[model samples]
Target: MLFVIHALDKPGALGARLAHYDAHKAFLSDTSALKVEIVMSGPLVADEASTMIGSLFVVEAADLATVERFNAADPFRAAGIWERIAITGFIRRQG
Candidate 1:
């Protein structure tokens, strides 16, 4: 099944997020089950187009457990960048 992992960074954790970004990207590149389609994250901009405050990723996994495992191993989690993580099963439809 495919899953979408939505993560919100802890308050004032931008430094942590930046510090772990390389590791996080490496993890994503090395993972087998996780296929990152779109990664959109940065500080939250006062305007809609400002910096990112969190991140959103579209991933594919076999099950919720797998997704959970992936989340647990993410560098953001290790660096305390994410305060909240929300995962949901996804169905993609092309019109």
Candidate 2:
């Protein structure tokens, strides 16, 4: 199954995001993490601007539990950058 992860960072938390960016990237790019089969993943901007506010990811997993486990280990979570996160089953139809 596929899942969509949308995470919103806390207001005014850009500093934390920037501080842990490299680590977060490393975690997301790790072979173990990518085993879930990521289709697309990247930071979300505020409003067509360079300011990022969160992250979005489309990935394939066995179930929600598997995705949850992966999320629990993400460096971004460890850095406490995500204020709210939503995960749901996904059906992709376009690029």
Question: What C-alpha root-mean-square deviation, in Å, does candidate 1 show against the real structure?
Answer: 3.1
All models: lDDT? 0.72, 0.87
List clashing residue pairs in candidate 2.
none
- Expressed as tens digits, the lDDT of each residue in 2-92 for candidate 1 is 6777787788887787788789888777676553333333334435675567777766666888778878888788888888889999888
> In candidate 2, what are the lDDT values of residues 2-95, reduced to their tens digit?
8999999999989999999998887877636445777789999988778999999988888898888888888888888999999999887877
Candidate 2 residue 70 Cα shift, in angstroms, is 0.8
**Model 2, TM vs. native:** 0.91
Question: Residue 71 of model 1: what lDDT?
Answer: 82
TM-score of 1: 0.80
In order of appearance, the predictions have TM-scores of 0.80, 0.91
Deviation in Å, model 2, residue 7 alpha carbon = 0.2
In angstroms, the error of model 2 at 29 is 1.3
Global local distance difference test of model 1: 0.72
Clashes of each: 7, 0
